[model samples]
Target: MIVTADLAMSLDGYIAGTGVSPDNPGGDGAEPLFEWIHNLASWRERQGMTGGEENRDSELMREWFDATGAVVMGRMMFDTGEEFWGDNPPFRTPVFVLTHRPRPTLVKEGGTTYTFVTDGIHSALEQAKAVAGGRNVDIAGGASTVRQYLAAGLVDEMQLHVVPALLGDGLRLFDGPGLGPRRLEPVRVVDTPLAAHLTYRFAT
Candidate 1:
């Protein structure tokens, strides 16, 4: 079972802009950061909605969704995306949220079930993998969570949808205590007008 992570980041390495609030979830530059996948037919289909342009971007999004069986994310993502995701979230799988505060199991309208993990990062990953069975467990992040997983060397595969934007100061995907040095083997690369999809596997 591969532990995977996927993110749409800016050219400056920021996953999200600063001043993230209830109103501006990804902050001021949030829209531009994730606009690539927002218009995909796969995104609309995941939301149980219809009518969206189908293309390579949409196909990529669909592949990611299909590949993932479980998800792990930070508390910030849950808080900020709760309202935006509405009653049904796009991830139609079990989600393990890393948080300080413990909450009751939130069962949504779709197959998605939010499980809060207060123990530790490894604990969350373990739970997610168990639920995922033999399928891949995705680390759906908000920077901090991704960093923790990466630093621990738990991620087997990663895909970054690099958008053409520069948010100098914000939450970065690699922000954390020094991860030292690491290497990645390029798996695939796809270029588009809005973003470039880069897939990599942790070097063995």
Candidate 2:
């Protein structure tokens, strides 16, 4: 199965604002950073079942959703504290989260279940791959998980959502050690008023 990583970053490359506080929260509340994705038709159709996607970015977003099978996330994403994903979640596939803290196996009514992976990213990837079959395993977000996959050379594709915002600092997605040189060729580019969607395939 193919392993793909996807994330959204500011123009200055920051994922969240300077301080990881509660009031300020993630860079620009983090919601504005991903409003572009939330507005996509595929995102609504697959995630919420309502919304109009009529731009290039939405088109690419739909393509990514269609290409994905299983998804993986980090502890920070599983928390109900920092990120508020409203009453209903947007993901419909099985999602595995990496963390040392154990939690109950989440089985959402909308078809999403949060499984904790204390064993590590390797274990999570193995499980994700088995569940993904031949479609593709997707790395949802969080810098650490992506870095681990990159270092292991397990990522086959990457999609970056470059939003026009500056968070100064928060979590740098590319801050960790560089794993040699992995070539990423752009497969698709979508420009919109909100964000630019860039999809690339790993070429090493």
Candidate 3:
């Protein structure tokens, strides 16, 4: 099973704008990054909402959701998304959360269960893979989580929805030192009015 991470990023390389908190999860000026997918039929369906545009973006979203069996995400992502997700989370699979604090397993509706992993990224991935049943394991993230997996060479593929807007200062996806220099082979590119869907596989 391939380990993949997907994120909507700004033209300036920021996945999230500055001042990210539980109160303001995506942070300031981050709306442009995700505005593309918010109204997609696939996304709306997952959120239990109705009536959204059925287009290439929605189709791509459906494909990704269908391919993923389990997910691993950072604690911050979980905390910030918990309230917004309500009882029925979009992920209808097991989700292993990487966090230092130990918390009991949280079972939500729609087959989504949050299993807090205090050990580390490796431990969280291991557990996610074990339960994935050969389906792809997704690194569902908030920038930092995706960076950790990429640094460790755990991500097999990455899909970046590059939005046109730019965020001058925020959480850059490729920031920090651990990543160094690496070659990424382009798998595909689907350009749309809202964003450009870029898929890449790490070159071996």
Q: In terms of lDDT, which candidate is strongest?
A: 3
The lDDT values for all models are: 0.90, 0.75, 0.93
TM-score to true structure, per model: 0.96, 0.85, 0.98
In model 3, the worst 10-residue window by lDDT is 29-38
Residues 38-64 of candidate 2: C-alpha lDDT, one tens digit per residue = 667777776556767677777777667
Please give, for residues 70-170, the per-residue lDDT of candidate 3 as tens digits. Answer: 99999999999899889999999999999999999999999999999998999999999999989999998978899899999999999999999989999
**Model 2 lDDT at residue 58:** 70
Model 1, position 122: C-alpha lDDT score: 98
Model 1 agreement with the true structure over 1-204: per-residue lDDT tens digits: 899999999998888898997777888766778877777899999989898979999999999888888999999989998899988999999999999999999999789999999999999999999998688999988888888889899999999999998888888888678576999999999998989999999997
Model 1's alpha-carbon lDDT is: 0.90
Model 1 residue 90 CA deviation in Å: 0.4
Note the clash tally of each candidate: 0, 3, 0
Q: Which residues of candidate 1, in runs, are more than 4 Å off?
A: none
Compare the candidates by TM-score and give the number of the best one: 3
